[model samples]
Target: MARWEIKNVRIAGVAAAVPRNVVYTTDFDFFTLEEAEVFNNTVGIKQRHIAPEDVCASDLCFAAAEQLLADLKWERESVDVLIFESVTGDYKTPPTSCLLQDRLGFSEDCFSMDIPMGCCGCMYAITTGGNLLSSGNAKRALLLVGDTALRMGSMKDKSRVPLFGDCGTAMALEYNPTASDIVVDFHTYGKGYEALMTPHGGFRRPITKESFEYEDFGNGIVRAPLHTLINGMNVFSFAISKPPRSIETFMADYRIDRERDVDYFLIHQANKMIVDRIVKKLKLPLEKVPYNLEEFGNLGGASIPSLMVTRLRKQLMTEEKSLLMSSFGLGLTWGTMWLRTQPMVVSELVIL
Candidate 1:
């Protein structure tokens, strides 16, 4: 792999937006204990937030960007490029990023595009923004991610309904002139596609009322017998093996140790069980892993950024901290990135 030289690129700010409405685990009372037991085994997800029927992924993303820009005190003009990552986009055409850019009042000269890569979306977005900055194509970039897969499912597909939620997160990347300050690495695996996917609703099988009523799969969540198929076991097996292997490989390749080296492990908030599994396998301390799944559930691509923003606002994060972030699952994709924290704001000094 050829290494690219990057100068002073720092994550200037971060923010996340979760829907006001949240669905609790108790909401699953509709499912029998036996059926729910089959679903909850290994893969631990109790509750997830769902966007209102009319709310699109872009809505969550835009709200997140608004809060992020305001918190950073950054003008829209400072953003030269924007990337929106989502599988559940606002539309099939007219990339969601375009709508978001306008909504955020970004300048006309800014370049905007959308990437639809599911769970790996955030990693791809981060890498995209980093390259855009290092290439001098843009001075600063905004990487936004959001998804509402749960709302996209039919009412009958209760299996996936409780696992996904609507959320949006934003990260600001700035170009710096110093070479040693900013560095990054990435890798991906796409062989895991069939292991997880929305079974219907696209060019292959158009939606129809009949499709909605069909129950060939013995489940009501189908348009033409639609089932949000997921091999829970496969996903967990790959997640456990892949994430740790990648992290260890990257650390060894970079010659870094966990003790006195990296400051944080910001894994995607996939679920409590998966998060805990990886944490135990890696033998990483709880403090090293910053998570908020209990409060927000799985926000898909928005998980990592949302956690970062929440921690920062709570004054739980500090300057010059080294954060190691890993993203995995969906498309069977995964990657690890090292970041240095340079907070956008400092504390206020008040007289007693």
Candidate 2:
């Protein structure tokens, strides 16, 4: 685990853009009526927004970034850094961040890059952006984190299909000398990467003749080599343990009392049971944590920012808040970050 604190930076605003298309769990083609009902009642995801085949993760992030910049009323040329994090890139060669910088009309001088990560990308991206701003070199930065994760799901893969929701999210960070600082903690267990992964398509495995072949693992779990696979038990166990442990350690390390110092715990919208367990372990008040899963489903790295727009938009726009956000999954990663938010532009959810 690596821990750090960023100084002289604050959140300016946040925005989320999801596909206009919605897929209700009841409409799941692969599940029998009884199966869908059981899954829905257990997972608590009634529906999810899924991007079409033509839409890339960058497109959603682009929409979100546009809305965020517009609501923030910040000139494009003023944003000195743009970091795009996603598992879905537009191309195998060019970083998605570079393409976003160009599309967003940012100046040529803006430093743009990509962090190819999954659910925990948000915390890491914010840490990077905040530190860059704190250095007094970049006054403003965009931290983009999202994924069309479901795009990699096989339509017949029961273990994954019904659980994923697609979305892209953006956050604006501005250097402010007097603003509250940011504290972040990161933990990565690469050994367990197989717990959730797309076995082929990348250079490691490359595209083979069998890569596109679909195999049915009974119980409706079917997928090609190119699709994502999951070890539910592995992820669920980590979700209920690693994240809460990290959050608890972070609080103790920073001497933060949840009741006294934090306003909300915005966790990744992965699983309902996972969220409840972490909340219980930390002894956190239910009201202190906001969930977007029931409406938006699990949004991977986009959960935190999307949760801000969908659940706490008005409060974030009208008052100062101390927020603790935790996200864990894919890459077998988990992280928790704490930040104080000053009343700022919180945009209405953008449908792309």
Q: Tell me each candidate's TM-score.
A: 0.87, 0.97
lDDT of each: 0.72, 0.89
Specify the highest-lDDT model's number.
2
Instruction: At residue 108, give the lDDT of candidate 2.
Output: 99
> Tens digit of lDDT per residue, candidate 2, span 229-252?
988999898889888998898999
Worst 10 residues of 1 by lDDT: 343-352
- Tens digits of lDDT, candidate 1, 166-204: 787777888876534444555556677777776567778
- Where does candidate 1 stray beyond 4 Å? 1-6, 32-46, 179-185, 204-227, 312-317, 345-352
Clashing pairs in 2: none
